[model samples]
Target chain A: MSINKDTIVAIFLLLFCGIMINSSFDIEDPGYQGMKASFWPTIVLCLLSVMSLVMLIKSMVSTTDNNLNSENTNSQNIFLKFKNASICFLMFILFLAFLDYLGMLIGGVLFVFGLLTLLGGFEIKKIINHSIISIITIGIMWSIFTFGLKVILPEGEILRIW
Target chain B: MIDVILQAFASIVLDPVTLGLMFVGTLAGILAGAIPGFTIAMGVILTLPFTFGMTAIQGLATMLGVFVGGFSGGLMSCMLTGIPGTPSSVATTFDGFPLVRSGRPGLALGLGLWSSFFGGMISAVILVALAPQLAFLGLEFGPWDYFSLIIFALTITVSLSGGNITKGLIAGLLGLFAATVGEDEINGVARFTFGFDDFKQGFAFLPVLIGLFAFSQLLTDVEDDKRAKSPLMSQSGTVVKVEHRQAILIILKRWVNLFRSSFIGIFTGILPAAGGSISNILAYDQAKKASPNRSNFGKGEYDGVIAPEAANNATAGGALIMMMALGIPGDIVTAVMLGALMIHNIIPGPTFIQDEPLLAYGVFIAFFVAHFFMVGLQAFSLRIFLLVTKIPMYVLASVILAYCAIGVFALHNIVFDIWVMFFFGVIGYFMKKLGFPLAPMILGVVLGKLAELNLARATGISDDMLLFISRPWSLFFLLMAVISVIFPFYQEAKKETLFAKLYVPVSMIVLSLPLFLMGSPVRMIVAVILVLTGAYFLYKRTSSLKIT
Candidate 1:
């Protein structure tokens, strides 16, 4: 009784669309309109819902006919398989969250260096290499945006000096 | 006209300062185009401020150089990395990156570069010779026609879906849903915001684009620890060179495809709001349908690279024709150029060519000359671009992600865009893993607003839905849409199938209805010919079937 991955995805999408369609009703309709604001979104969501249902049914049929547990192979240790991507994504979120506080220059350098160590290795030599590459790369980018294009990069809130 | 063109050419080439500025602008445009999340429109907008101090010809030339270079610059990153540097280059990755993966980066780069050059040259000729006439075609499209045309464009999702039609449809529907999240343009009502103010803006197109194509791609590249530490490409030992001679011969052999794709680009460009993004994909779809080796398209076919690369570059010339002759901006880049012209106290309209002959012709010459410069400059810069493959995947991914952040932030100077990028990236990554094709989704997002807007406008104009079928242009697009939707099925059908046998003649007969309705004598004659040819084919097929 293993649920196929695609079946789960389809069910999730159907639920999301159901939620969206429900919310479409809450949209404030400014009575003066030829078509309501929710008209297009509702149509799109209905189509999505139909397609998701189709996907769900198709996946279920295929799974039944084949008597296959495709999900079992990959679903056992999903976290282990996606650990690197998960960490990278977490780092990305953290970097963006504290971007204003750390500024692009310092923030960018740290982000790059951390990613490099996480992705490459944490050996002392690799750390030094990562440090140099991060600083140089971030420095050049910062200089180009700040100087050449005249685009003002975000100076950190705390590090802001007149 | 010849004298005016010569005068324009002399002004651009003879002046060192203008030439220097154009050169610089082209280089800058290439840099902008080669970076993921950076757009050609942004490059032109940045160059716009610098143009204010220069003479009208110099200013236009500089911007035109950027415009031309940016279109071609996208191919470098597209082939080297799976990520498209610009939205227009998205289709290039279909075959270009796969070709790179197959260890022919040189051939792919050369093909892309040369195709762009030829496509640009073809469109430039048309722009100069028939700007007024072609610009007039743009005026013929009503909201009904535009909506129908988008419907036709949306049918490409069938072709993009590969083997999973249901997943593709769901992905496309999701994209359309995403577009509908923001405030309604005509009426200022938010539909899917859910009371969150940040969601009102919905997803900015660029952030979504970068997130889906660039950020998600980077995550995939670094998903495996061992793979992340290695260089981007496997061909680490060999020095990659652009196989210019080989590429030229290959392009020359496929002259019909090159010409057809360029024409497609030019036509799409002439239509307002339809830009390089649409043109490239349209060209790729047409190429795939026409190619004998259609199955090889997403698997690294040369036709795939040639069609998109050529079409996107040609689109610039098509856009310029509308801007110069009709006072209409064909796309965002041309819209910015139009603003630059207005800044110079020049207004473009129906009589713009008559009023500002020198400046108008200057634009034509500059556009032509910029292609030459793009070819020369790209040849040199491509060597440097190839070095990107040598960087470790992790390093490249991290750096590109940072650039993606910066580029997205720079677009609006807002932190919200960065968040949008991250959110979409996660969704895109999941979609990829689930085997839901991303191309259809991207197409849906790009065309969704235009489709909705036109649909609304069409309905508002008249309560009678019969107008959608009665209008010649609308009917024409509807026919094309029907054909486009069934094309994949037709292509996949066995040769013995009745559907396969009837597909060509039926398509011809059905498509000719619009031509006949057009009322022009030439079009009527063409329609008559089509009917005769289609009838002849139908008769032959029926006769053969009876004998069998």
Candidate 2:
């Protein structure tokens, strides 16, 4: 279901109010009373809520450019939104999973190659060329980070086996 | 003064390590900046783990170089195509693409390069002269001021929300709400831990930022790509066409708007919290407002191209003031520099200036050298940056996801951050889908800890909440914040309500109560001047809006 701005904003306002109400219960001990942390947070929340209320009124009264008119939905698809984002998410998981198993050099190489080829749709021949370039560049990065700069990387499966 | 800067310059130039660091920093920064989606600060933060191995100077020098380059490299995107490489270059795209369309990519590039360099130089001169005085003044700011200032910053986000201001505030407040999770900033009590030790550190800032900026952006990009009707968009391809003479004189002519915007950029940059993104927007807006010819704007006016281009790039010199003088960071990039310094156990406040004078000077010298390298390198390698812009949407989308995960894992080697990231990604997606601005949420998260900590310190007692308002600087910001909040409502209501029309003068007097309570007479004078200026904007916007 396409959510309205009012609905989303309403949820936000509800959450802020809830948080402020809950935080108000926080009364610190007497000695620490002067610098009581909750005090400032409450102020921030209170101001936020007022600003939010003002926003809600504005949105409610605003014009109809939303999904009630199918024209808006025609231009924006929810699934397409998830698809591009998922590629990135999936690649990240791959980067992490291999960071230790492949060693920094090999792992970075595969990750970039796999990312480029899989996501980029390069043919096998182009993959090899791109992989070679990526690996070489990563080699420089590895030396720069580990050798010269001293950043540590996971040794992963390669180091364990060797 | 010349001798001082000269000595500082010579000291920095003589250091082999500093020289090397500057080169590496500038080059790496240019690469990071040229590519869309990679921020200079994000680049530094991503590579921070590597900096753990280097000295403080080396680490900071490299980050600064990258920051400068990232801001400068954006011009390529603006010039070659209408799209901005970075958010800071959105204004550049206004005229930059027009210039390209007019067959003057070289002029766009040249103007971009020199004006940015000139802007940085002018800002440096200002910073070197006035930073100490400014820093001393900033030191006087108390807790209430922070409380007010952050609120004021948060309020500005509402203006950016675009039509549905409430949704924006809601997202922002939700972000503030998110900050309360994990461990309490004070008393170490868990507010929203829900019972896991995982919540103790709160959500990792960088990971959350990655999710919000990079992850959510990926989702939006994917949606954008999916909806693309062009068969050419999906076909993975390489196309590079550069046809234009380098117009150096065109750059020289635009120096008028370029310098005007640059000065505005420098001043805004000197203030804490304003970063490249805001500097560019404000500079573009200022240029548009100040131009005698407003209709030319957004249609590819030359001033539109240079205003943001110069300001966004110039702000780097301005941010250095806060970094070198006060320990306070103006933005995330400087914050990363602070972290680098911390890794070296090098404290950054006023003492940093006296103790590491040459090191600080070296950073300054590096900025000069780095800008020169960035412009020269980009002029030749324009193809590389443009080629990056050509990546098929599906493939680019995947890379965005990959980086988000990498960034999530980078923070603490914890899978927990991945969850926070995904959660924020979902949150950010909805925020965007619902018309809320994500910048406020991120800013809210960034300032949350500082405001809490400062307020606690100011109170000096756990029980006395009111102590925050007792101080001068704190009260001043608080008053300013009140004005910021009420002014919008007043402005909006003036046209629609007879009550507002009848009572605005009296209500304004009441609204300006915080000003009257000022501790410094100087602050009072500034406040009055500000009120008058604000009134002008308020009256103008409201009247125009009502008329429409």
Candidate 3:
């Protein structure tokens, strides 16, 4: 028997609520206060758990409607969509990692260049075009934020030599 | 007061620095709004940190430029490619695209621009006049009343969540939960920090907002297989020459629609969470009902273009009114603006008007200047608008990703917020995939602190939980919340006879089980209501099913 995606989501949220409730207990209460630090979180966790249970049951019961189930399954290539989003997500994680060591200017340029190549592929002309645009964008952004705005961005130890 | 207003206006107009910044800001806003997949809200969020370095009026002046320009810029893509640049301009595509297809692209573009300007002017006038009165009302609200007002605001989720109350409520509750992660405002004790030092300051709403909206959108764009489609500029179409004066006069002749739609835009804008999306659709509906050439509407009637365009642009003024007068944001953009203002140490609301009347009035004057600048800028920059659509998706996506990273980093020179943004981006993506709406979640984040603070204040005063319902204003709001939540269910039930049948017995069992276990009076009352309504619906459904 195939488990419905809706049921899977409901189960995931149910588990998240369980964790949230457990975490809520660790929140130190303000002694005899009107509402404790954990008060709203606990209420929300209870509501969320109840809602997740209903959602799970609803998905289970609605499985008899083959039309709805088929419609949900046949909407798009979920695997392909997940793959593409995962690539971008990985690229973003890389960008975040780069920002600390490379500084905003260098890290931003590398991220833009890398992402453009990832999306458009490694055509020489396009890569060159992407590189030029990335440089120009980073140069302007660095100057504006660093000099014009006087907001200090992370200049990393390596880039501090410059 | 008049002298102060004049002085504020003079300071803005005479100072070349402010004037130039406003022009640049408007141009940027137009570019931001004109780009497909970029929203005015996103534009406002991206622009917030830049305003940190500028004066209050100057920063606000620049943002106003973005606000006005973004609304007007959406018309470009709608006419040219039949794709709305922003959601607010979705209706503009129906008639504007048809007009473009008929080779009167110039007329559609011209009429839309002029309508936007006039609609913006009308809303600005009303905002100037009505906001002071509304602010006076806001000033009278005590803690109990303020809590009630917030409840009314939260119910906006019912209208916005695309007819899914349970999902909307869950999203809202999730947002409220996220808001509690930081130090407790009352006790200074951290909640839900999960032992991370970074979580102590909590997730900054700005970074979180950019993540949910801009970053998540970028992620979705990347997931599209055909993300590298040919630029819109490659399409060849004739733009018939339009007489600007003649077109303006023709749009002006529909004075009833202009005023009516603008009023709808303003009123809807003032309502918390009801932004241009609702206003445009409502205005279009009203115009269709009143139009003599109603049948011609969807078939390229100019009135169709005028109504939604006018209404949506007018929403800018209407939204600003709430932000300026009551200190409550009517929508996401204003919420961001409130954040920016707080960053500059300028508090909005009734006290804003009383203390910084000149600055408050300066903001009003800034809108007028921004609209005027929008007209001049949009008129001569038609070629640039055409070029904006031609930007490649990958390049755009990459630039935005970098911008998001840089913008969040610039906020406090911290990278933790960027990580928080990334975390929320993943959550937002999954939520969207699961058919949950993000608007309610964002609204929850914006209003959560307010709601918590006010509820605490009110509860402290009353010393009884039941006092919330005993207060007349609070009771009224709770009643409104009930109606807002149940009315949609009621409407859905009326449509689905089978659902009404199944829902009743199921809800009765569900409610009764909890009531039996808990033995709470409130649970019993709720269960009783469910049984009665469920029984009535079940009976009606059975009768209908039998007849069938």
The top-ranked prediction according to lDDT is 1
Per-residue C-alpha lDDT of model 1 across residues B421-528, encoded as one tens digit per residue: 899999999899888877667667766776788788987888778988999889988887778667778889997778988999989998899999999998899999
DockQ of each: 0.49, 0.33, 0.57
lDDT of 3 by residue, B294-345 (tens): 8888778889989999999899999999888878888888888888887777
Model 1 residue runs over 4 Å out of place are A1-3, A63-68, A75-81, B1-119, B127-132, B157-163, B234-367, B382-386, B546-548
Off by over 4 Å in 3: A30-34, A64-77, B232-242, B490-548
DockQ class, candidate 1: acceptable
- Compared with the true structure, model 3 gives a TM-score of 0.88
Estimate the TM-score of every prediction.
Answer: 0.75, 0.77, 0.88
How far is B268's C-alpha from truth in model 1 (Å)?
Answer: 11
Error of 2 at B502 (Å): 11
lDDT string for model 2 (B1-548, tens) is 45656776775577677667666666667656765656676666655655555666666766777788788777766566555667777778777778667766656666676667767767767767666666566565555565665666565545443444555566667677677666665676655565578877888776677677666765665554433212212322222333223333554566677778888888777665567787888888988998888998876676777788779877887888877776656666776676567557676665566677666766676667667766666654565554555555445444345444444454466667767887787778777776677766776676666657666665563446565566555555555555544555665674646445534444444444456566468767765765676576567545644443
Evaluate model 1: give its lDDT. Answer: 0.81
List the TM values for chain B, per candidate.
0.68, 0.77, 0.87
The order of the candidates by DockQ, greatest first, is 3, 1, 2
Error of 2 at B25 (Å): 3.6
Models ranked on TM-score: 3, 2, 1
